[model samples]
Target chain A: MKKDKLVIGGHEFQSRFILGSGKFSLEMTNAVIQNGGVEMATLALRRANVGGEGNILDYMPENITLLPNTSGARTAEEAVRIARLARELGCGDFVKIEVIHDSKYLMPDNYETIKATEILAKEGFIVMPYMYPDLNVARSLESAGAAAIMPLGAPIGSNRGLLTKDFIKMLIDEIDLPIIVDAGIGRPSQACEAMELGVDAVMANTAVATAKDVPLMATAFRLAIEAGRSAYLAGLGRVLESKGEASSPLTGFLQD
Target chain B: METKMDHMVYLDYMEQVDSDIMERVLDTVEQYDYNTYIVEDVKAALCKDKLDIDDFGALLSPAAMPFLEEMAQRAQKETRAHFGNAVSLFTPLYIANYCENNCIYCGFNCKNKIHRGKLSMEEMEKELQSISKTGLRDILLLTGESRHQSDVKYIGEAVKLATKYFALVGIEIYPLNTDEYAFLHECGADYVCVYQETYNTDKYEEMHLSGPKRIYPYRFYAQERALKGGMRGVAFGALLGLGDFRKDAFATGLHAFYVQRKYPQGEISFSPPRLRPFINNAEENPKDVHETQLLQVMLAYRLFMPYAGITISTRERAGFRDNVIGMCATRISAGVKVSVGGHEEEAKGDEQFEISDDRSVAEVLSSIESLGLQPVFLDYIRV
Candidate 1:
């Protein structure tokens, strides 16, 4: 059997879990990655200061890929500038475009995300835009040359888990690009359910950082994701609509 | 012998302004070349189904002035999508007019020799009862900046009294510490409105020469402290004409944006009050914030933040107020009496500023209905 791999921007990643490093210390993040078998990590541009004291890059493992995000940008121009800066810092070409103007809900500006994605992708950068789970916006992002479309399960840091499951499923069904669920997945079970629904990957931050044992929580998420992927590959069974059928044969062995 | 004013507890509550966010706002405003935007850019911004910060800038630029009709149409559509043809109506009740601050533009400044009165509990209840009879459910309690005359406890008592008559109680008074706001919130205050007055710090210092209000950093973070105190909503604004109106408006929006981001559960609102001449001083007027520009700012705010509550106060004219009922303004002040003890009795103190719309509550309600919008007095019920 061929091993299924999560591929984004021509890069292959054996681990499907994408760790978010906003609230966690760099050492904690490294520990979590090692325990959870993570291959990619998202770091805010502010935290990726190269020569600054206690730079986050110093504590990262060699095998992990850095995905720098434009966390503070409220406009498309600002997001483009941040993406260029991230590349200059040797963070490679992977950039997560997160343009937010609605600060109350911290909702992603889908219009701005599409704009930023188009500009960065044209500049030879792998643009993975974090966005609201809207099918129309997802299609626009794909057309804008996004490496992958990252739809949010809920608001950032909200551990509410997969509130947009139906919408994301629509994207997975309709869009040709990889569908990565980002933000709002608070539990391993939720991540498993998303995988079962055929999402390419899950990105989480607050769930692990808020856990009592960070690395342990990361491991739990890892096991759940793998189990889900295996189940999906084996094919989920049909669900009975109304009544339950008995496992034993109703037709006679001897009497009938 | 130690009085509450002597403690000045809010002095300890002053926090250093978040310099990063401030720098971002200042830099964006300083570097914004609105002139570089052409009609093509404005058209592009208008044509987009979804607008971003850049689009908002384009809409605010002079190039977009020729496209006012288009901007207003889109703004109205956005407002309808979020608010659903409902205009919230409330009235302001000035409980005290004894200000200690020496602001150069206000009527109630301590330097003015006008009547200064703080409502007694009896007078306040009478006023509340009188306004409550108008079928209005939201009341905003305001006072001039005088801690010695109107202490936190007095404000808390007024809030407690107001909660008895009104379903929603908001306060627009001197900024308070977190604990003070919490105490008022415990007294049933749901909203706190503090105008930054102007975002230009130098102009702010020059205008407010003396008093605790002179502490720029303290006033800048009042809404945050109020939210920290567990208030449900906070309103923000920049008094137009004190500085560059465009930059002030932009800063006000960004301030509300960032604060609401941190406190997503808190309801956010904007009250863009223009400068009106104070009592006995009718010569002062807003420098360049004309009606068209004011409408532009309001429309820009609506397109940028559709869900925010934008209050068009009585400072604007009655006809103008009527024209803007359902356009982009979601909230309107009706039957306002800005003098202490003026609603139910003879005026005891001078008015804060001249109110152009002296229409009765019933009149405002009719105007809202005439415009085919619902007049909402209370949208949410307390638990």
Candidate 2:
């Protein structure tokens, strides 16, 4: 029942989902990630330890590759610096560039993100730009040499649960790179819906972080993502607009 | 066509109008099938036939209070249907208690010899941290009417400071110009609440003898200014015991009605704060309003503007507040301490006003749940 291989940035992930490292104790976060069966997790560089004993890196499992994120950086320059720091701190090669200019909404600055992605790709880093679900922006990011494109289902930490469904579906249909739906997912059902739309992966924190039971919610998300992916691969049943008669009178009429 | 009556003339005529006319308006509102029809007809019916003061009188009369209960109940059901079974909770954080105003009702009057306290940036942070522990995501920043000590710049800084902890931030400070209001909104203020205190021109002048608040029309038109400033919502309220409750109530409703009509996109809320017992000579306070009357006022507000949010603060008793929540009230202040630096521990020696409902946020949530209503912590998302 578990078909959990997903490819991003030319690297294979045994798990189809990624978890965020914020708003959870290290022990509880580790328990949730381990329980959820995630292969990789994203950690914010701002929240990471700098010459400290108990950094996020110290708590995470050795096998779990750290995908450092530029969460607080609001411009291309700041994001690049954060990415460099993460690379220096041994999180090599890959960076999740989140240059959000809108402080109120935390919406990614598409202009800054593209500019940063171009520079980072030139610098030999596998850059995944967190962008709006706009097809044009996603295509631009891809052209700018981004390894993958992250589109928000809704605003960050809003728990609004897939507000951009139609746009996300369109992005999934159009983009060649892996589409990772990030942010605004409140429940496992939303995650499942995103996965069913054929997004390559989902990254979440607040849904599990703020839940009454974090590890249990993590497991629920894992199961939901698997079920949705399976349903997608097996092909969904056709939806009927109206109920059809059990016996077709038209067939008898045709024979007569 | 309804005759155009001056605001004061209309209020005076309202006292002498017949009760039967009020009954007709109520019946007309009830019999109307469509919401648009009711909205149009109710306003038309009340204002029709030479601005029948009788209908206004009847709607507010004691006889109408019982019938108004039905309207309030309907409004409550609609409020519950739209907003769900939850009371939106928020706390008002008083930044500086220094007032240049000489408003007669307040404890923080400049002339009064009470211990005045103001929080510096560091103190304000401590207050924010203390309030954040209550699990409250909405806050209203309040201040005294000191233009020099606590001006727009000071308030804007406070609003910015508040955004770090709260998802929604509002102000209940002095009125500002449109540009100043816009500046505060840019600093992340979601709402602005400025009570006209009393709308009766003569009483308004007498009560606010000194300070910038004494400027009557300027304060009266502040909500309009706030709307122009790009605020998402504005709250209107009147000090219940300051003047004749009926006249004041009528004016308050009219103010809200005009603003709502003017700014259809903005959200409007109404609060009816009765004068609570102050420290000096509580006995000699001749203008104390009754609880039943307060309930009647709240019920009337709900009946008048069914969509407007009715908020009850900690000025009321726990039993009365508990009862009103199910009736017509939709928002409340819980675990409230009105004094400066109150949340850090027991309020510092100097406090503003005495808070009635002293229950913690957890206790308030449980109490609300016991009444079969859900306690929603976060309802609004920026997206």
Candidate 3:
């Protein structure tokens, strides 16, 4: 069998699960990453600062790729500067452009995200823009050279799974890039459902971080995502339009 | 109804108040067009698994009234998803009923000829002892909007007294400065409840008439100040009948939404108290807010902010409280007495307003258990 891989910006990843490190404690970061079988992890640059509580980089394993996010950037210029700073700080060229100005909902500004994606992609960065699931905006981001478009399943940290299901489905059907669902995925079943819907990858943070056991929840997400990806690959069964179909041949029954 | 000197005081307080939040709320209220929503829009709003602000508006509109059953089911599912079957119980102890405001609707209005009183520290402790004996760990301390009679020092002392008996002490008194709220929080107040009586400033001005409460912006910012004071939680409410019920309800949800966003760690709750008849206004009922409408508002709030704590107070009837608790409400006020210092002895003053469900704590607990829900007294403990 041919091995499947999630390709973003010409980089291959065996793990389709992208772990968010924003909410996890530094002590648990490595365990959660290893338990979840994560090959890629996103971190805020501030958490990696040398003088902070403790540098998150020290806990990261050698095989993991760090996808630094521009979390505090409210405009395209600010996002670009943060991306450059992340690169200068020895983090890789991979950047998640999160240009958010709406303080209430923490909603991403697709316009600013597109601008930042263009600027960062031009500077030879693997740019991924977290966006609202709007088709036209997704197209613009693709045109602006975003490697993968990460659309929110719900508001950030809402633990609401696939509230934007219909729009995200439209993106999956139309957008010609890896459609990685991000944010608000609370339970393993939700992540599995997203994977079954054929999303290329899933990014989760709060759901696992706030769990009763962080590492256990991380493993649950990993298994669910893998099961979902396998199921998607296997091709899900069809549903009846009206009535139930018998599994054991109704006409072949002895009573019949 | 107000004197020239009262107008002078109102103007003086107005000068000292910040109006940025009020302006934002009023702008939202003025621009909200509930009438523009159609049945299709409401249907579309209800179809989504999770709701946004526009969907919230549609659910609160008249177009959504016919789909009340559907809304209730969705609200129930959201409630069960977020809060499970655990309903927290708390009782409000009115520590004082003295007011410097001339708000015409309230029984405790200074101009009203109602008996006024403030609880002494010993009296407050006795009341707290009586309440604490009921196995109720959460207690909210309320006072009429009067700083002169019930100052910050007196409220702080009452809070300090409450902390000794109750595990969680909350304040629903007059709006205080950030420093004053800090003082009360330092005295062990865990939460603050401030109802911006009405968000419509014009209606607010006409209704408030006079007093420091007439300073709209100061009261609007009370919850933010309370959060800044290091309180763990803050509750938002609006007297439902004071203005347009739907818009007022929307503004209440939006206010809490913004505050919760600014302080992500802060706990937010909602208490949608209708305009019950007070002493001066015995004939008054909620202008347009009936039971179904109030339920709709609460369901909308639950769908909008699933994590928020919605307190169904004893202001509603017993049956309504029971029905809504399983549907959307996460908290209830049991064994309530609005009069100042009434738990351990005879009433010391007139009650703040009438209460409909006068069920005792044990009865309320039994009722909650019968509905297959757990009645929690204290969900969080202060170290």
Candidate 4:
């Protein structure tokens, strides 16, 4: 039973978990989807037959939604080209725009991403942008017809989860589009915590793919995500900072 | 044809430098009385609210040697104030070692008997991939002044290729016309670096016997032409040992000073590269630039041009480079190969010169951090 199905570009998805298909064996994709039950998976558009494995698309199951990323793009025009090429490759309309110019810090250029989103949105591509956790940029991306905004939990592949949790929380409280936490998420609990924050989805590539057992890690992530999502849906209690708010009334003890 | 070694008859490069600004600086070199008020003038400058050109000139005098400790202290404070703790890292990839010039001091000189190599597009990719694996995001492309093997098109192509692996790309090669520089800029090179081996025209003529590099004024104004060509930045340097170090230091400082004033909006950086030894060519003569003087020149540079970048290269020993980096220098080269096809881990093919510090990029990075500074491989983001 799908409690909260994800809808993007008139396509309904049964799972909110998006697998990253880079830096891992393509053979693991089937097992990941089979066990973890992720509805969509993202791949980078690089030189054709990327990493000498032939087309990465051929390895993915036909049922899985492909979210092609603009990872090599250093400018808005570059990102747009990658996006257009992904669409031409029959990966459907979904595009994850990443325009990063600062290779040292590997931080996304917020202005350039907004520019790319405007261009791609007009071209009828379902634009999902990976960005820094800046609320103003999130608002601008929403205006640029982005399907959702995925902000980095930390630097890509760092596995240093939720370093920007406060900023992501602000984005979740304010922005209307779905907020999927991507990058630097190293553990299942971190993914679960993001879900408890009411984020629409969780995506982790290095955390699962780098594990000794990818499929097993994927299953753990799926269970944690479900548990967190269910807790959010059941209306989790508030965190009392000053003292504990007793779940049971203090005066209800039999001795009293 | 060789001119007489008389320093005056060969001030041709000096005469061709048509700027009143440069003329004023050279005239200061001709007229300043370094012997009269050397110590007091420097001390007075140290106490001044604002420093003037005369103050900068005084800082270069022999009398200022005693106050080097003070100069270094102030220079370090100002450097920290301006640049903070980030030491920007870059690696130099030699595209081609071919040369037409016979600069006696350089290993790439035409007369030097050393192996010359050039990288093809595929080889360049291999080198870049090796460099990229180290996670370095800034690169400087170097070549000799050879019109035959390393022409403008060849260099422009190299710069374009560099953009795929690096976010910031700079070129250090032959001087070009404004149009040529503009073409290279459009090819995605962000900066140009030209080291006028020595500003003293007599030493220049003696060093550069027969080549396009013989004309000093043209080489001196390469940065200006590069700026005209629309490059975001231009780097200036002098080889440091060929001429009178004091006068060369003043001229180098003054040249960068004038360029920064003219293109206040553009980026300007300075490097004082000491001559390093090479094969067959005794890289050093009896008259050499000593380490103490090298420190003084760099500190004086920072005192004069506080905002500009100063790069200390692998020419110095690692210990020396590590000492001056966070204090006066802001940029440095690491994991550098001065030969063509140098990126293959085992390939040391033909070195332009023997680098004093033979450390890897990661090794250089740890050295930067050990000194309580952050190592930044890239900074500029093209929006």
Candidate 5:
């Protein structure tokens, strides 16, 4: 009955498409971002060359809201410093705080992530924690002033596709803020499925980057996101029961 | 460590190289015992006259090739009994191809007429992102021997970049100082693999014509520097077919033995990679070590140092790889491409070397399973 336009930090995105800054060349990334019509894109902060000396930031357009990710920071303090640097480098208030203790799974440390989120949120930063699909941790981060909660579908880079679907759906049903499904999305269908489940937005990197055709894959993902969001807004058709069928049977004509 | 081999020590015993000692080592191995006794007993058995250069020769000789099936069975049993049946897999990420060295066998030789790719910090991130999706956690960062392009800072930056995506990151780049190794270790490098390529000083000089890599002892002592830098593991290897396989294998084994004896806490591994086809008809380079010889070297490594991890790359064919997996081979490279930016389905450009086993990860896993061996990923991680 009502169309929901997802808004993050007072910015409304008609299309619930979030782009990832990794994978493509700067020009290709910019083209994909423009074509996908994504309102927000996530960028990781590391000790990379930030100037025109072969840096990803050099390719970032000023219009798109940059969500600086603490993707490389193993500790909360390093994450905080990276967030500060991103802010100083013109990445507004939004910070995607990711403190991964285990490098293998890239699973966020709930304790350290919450700690970083609290610290960043208190310092006037819009904290959106990229976390595992732990509902309790999501709620805790939300209580700690996280603007949005990003729960992974599976281990980062796994591309296993929504292994945490039940837990993520539970969180979506329970949480009041936005539910952004992030990481472990290998195909466009997975993103569509996430959006169909009423997820506000989906952020992807590997699925597009490692594709045979990245730019084309990005466009396909854009279409999938729109279709999924539109379906969610329109409400899905009611599931049919095995016993129910409407038929006029001549044999049973006098029964009724 | 310096005790000479004694023939008179077994005077009271049957002197034909103590089968009792071999039996003891075999018994310890049979019991899945990996304590000091196993290492000590293996060392003793190897030290016994029974395990002479000729016996070692007998083990790796052409006659030993037929015994491979039996040797592999023994090695596989020992490996399974100790390290389990799963073969550890890892992919190498060549961060920079720029080189100052003029090594004769390499595609990235200083004089080669190929476009070199050196990823910047951002580009390195992009590369890592591309590779991360392949479901590989153990990664090796490689670079050509170029002090200008691949100095310690460059290697360390690559290590940091790799740390963003991988749990276990090893370096096979240019050799660095102990301090540089320490710096890389702090930057999250777990292991360092520096193959001497050839241990014979004269041949090493001849092979590495021009560059810092020409210095034999510097490369020879790289693993020691890495260990001194607090690395958890140091891998030693000789590029088979670089020189005489026998001499190289002997030197490589001795080097590993010395390193293991010195750094008992550190993990030691050996790789016997034969020179594959490269650009400019470099494949025509002499001293091509055959598959049988390669198997001999692998079996010898296992028989000599059973605990050491033996790695076989995709340079060998699929059948050879399959045959060797249950043998002394403890690790393998599957779906491997030696080219830069090769993770994408299509090759972006010319590859460094054509991969022999062009199977995908899934196919490799199924193959491993078909052999009645379990395919395991993330075997060491807790979660």
Candidate 6:
């Protein structure tokens, strides 16, 4: 387990946890990455300001992978435009496509996601798309050259853990690519349970960023991911309807 | 047509103001006693982990008053959770005040014998430089509802120059058709704000008198058309004193809620601007909405739609603006000027209304920080 690595898009990372930098205090950006032992993270592409708060990249450590998300995109065209602009920022080839149109539900549009992924992946971009869980869509995305399948655990920022557990599990069972459970993961235990269910990794922000102490929560999540992966590797025992026989049974008449 | 009003009345019951715009909708909305919403079904709704529109009437009722502080606390917590400790800042630089309407209670009424002027293209550019130099990136380009001078093309040119210095540009001007809004967007405007003024159409028609703005449905649908035209966001509001403030707040919230459902992709914000006094205005005695009531309405807005932006401007004083910045509202307009060519040069023309808070952007920033909050001057990026 110590030697294990989570691989995606031909890149290998020892930590399965990926930090989302939205809604987090700028000062905590470095801590969330360094102390949490996170090897990758996501940030949105905003217009470069000459001064003021500066860039999210300014706070990032030198050696971690950057997965810039197209968060404000509502259509494939918009998402593609963001992806191209992000590439121009020299953040490497990785892009996280989040094409969401339903503001009421805040659900990702899988059709547009696939369209954007197809266009982006062909243009030498490593595409990892966030989507609602669907096997057909996963297959479509895989054919479209997406590097990984990221299915939401629930709505974004909901903190309602694992409402889509079975759907995520279904993807893990059928989808040939790595199934990363993203969004709505509220607690550390929820992350542990996700790993125990054979998920490749869990990606979340609100679960830690909204906590009373962000860096502490980030540490808890790090340990939880490690524990879940170890338990999965150790092979948990099966459940039974009835209890097993005692070491000294009542059938021993003298003892009874 | 003039009467010394003692208390506000139902639009149907009023004989002085024109009741045509409100007649059909009044019967439907008047049935509910929203005054008791707090103690009735709304309390239960607010107690729940999540609230729906069914709880709207209860929150607006008189019963909701005792729970104002509680609602404010919740509003503060959720707003922080959603938008963070920052308040996105912008300042309106009025480019024109050449309105052509004969409203009874307005500073810019056609008969009011005041200066009518629009900023020349060069004047607008100079104003942009003046505003951009303030280090405020979000700019709102405003115009009088004039078709001839501040037409779509005129506003369009202003937007092009504004894109040079500002990352986010919004407009609060005459309502236009869908394609015209799209043209404005293509020309570099990112958002549009149109105030319905009063949801009670009768009061609105009586107030507006005669103009293209008299068409109620066109103004009502302007935000929707802006979204269709590909603007990233649109803001909604109503002038608070024209009708029952409670009822106006309720209608404004419901309108924004409906718009959110319709254009799920567009950002929604609500601004309930109070009626203020202007020099030479004939009707000076507009109804007063206490600061407490304004706070209550702001809390209700946060509870009903947690994600939408609540904006407070210079119409309210510095103290009220400071009190609400971190507590409920997520957006504020600082260093506002309400006259043509007000920013760049001598502001000699008649201002639409006198600004109560004359604080600069630095003043607003320091005040926001004194409350342990970060003042965010920018949120959206053009890339």
DockQ of each: 0.03, 0.04, 0.03, 0.02, 0.01, 0.38
- The best candidate by TM-score is 6
Cα deviation of B362, candidate 3, in Å: 0.6
Q: What is the per-residue lDDT of model 4 for residues B48-105, given as tens digits with 9 covering 90 to 100?
A: 6456788888888889989999999888765654455657788888878888887777
The lDDT of model 1 is 0.83
Question: TM-score of the candidate numbered 5?
Answer: 0.52
Q: In CAPRI terms, where does candidate 6 land?
A: acceptable
TM-score for chain A, candidates 1 onward in order: 0.93, 0.92, 0.93, 0.91, 0.90, 0.91
lDDT per residue, candidate 6, B1-383, as tens digits?
Answer: 65422212322311232223233334435565575454757569678776765576567667777888888888877776666566778999888877866666667777777887877878888888988887789999888778786788989999998998888899989887778888999999989999888877677767767766666666777787788888888888878877777777777777777778767888888896888887786367558577877787888888888888889979899989888876789888877888777777876357888789988887887787676565666666664
> Per-residue CA lDDT of candidate 3, range B1-383, in tens?
52523322344433243436656666776889999999998899888866887898898999989989998988876666455566778899998898988887888888988888888887888899999888887899999988888988889898888888776899999887788888998999989999987887778877887778887777788888888887878999889988998999989988988788777757889999999987767788779889999998999998888778899989899999999996899999999998887889877889878999999999998898787665666554343
For A137-202, candidate 4 gives per-residue lDDT tens digits of 999999989989999998776677999999999999999888999887889999988899888889
Worst 10 residues of 3 chain B by lDDT: B6-15
Best by DockQ: 6
TM-scores of the candidates in the order shown: 0.61, 0.55, 0.63, 0.60, 0.52, 0.89
**Residue A50 displacement in candidate 5 (angstroms):** 33
lDDT of each: 0.83, 0.73, 0.84, 0.79, 0.71, 0.79
Q: DockQ score for model 1, please?
A: 0.03
Question: Candidate 6, residues A1-256: lDDT per residue as tens digits?
Answer: 3677888888898998888776666567788887789988987775234365435667778898998889888889989998898788778899999987765567999999999999999998989999999889999999999989999988777778888888888888887777788888889999999888888888978778777788999999999998988888888887655766556767668753
Candidate 2 per-residue C-alpha lDDT over A1-256 given as tens digits, one digit per residue, 9 for 90 to 100? 8656788778998677789765454557678888889878888775553343224676788888788888767579989888888888899888999986442245788999999999999999999889888899889999999998899998776678899999988888898998888888878998988888898888887777666677998999999888878878877888766775456565675644
Worst-scoring 10-residue span by lDDT in model 2 chain A: A46-55
Estimate how well candidate 3 is docked, as a DockQ score. Answer: 0.03
Question: lDDT by residue for model 1 over A1-256, one digit each (tens)?
Answer: 8879888999999888999875543457678998889999987775443442235677788888999898767679989998898898789999999887554567899999999999999999999999999999999999999999999998776677999999999999999888999988889999999999999988987777656687899999999888878888889999986758777886757764
For every model in order, what is the number of clashing pairs?
0, 1, 0, 0, 0, 5
Q: What is the i-RMS of every prediction? A: 19.6, 12.7, 12.9, 13.2, 14.8, 2.8
**Model 5 segments beyond 4 Å from truth?**
A1-256, B1-58, B61-66, B282-288, B344-350, B379-383
Which stretches of model 2 miss by more than 4 angstroms? A1-256, B1-57, B284-288, B345-349
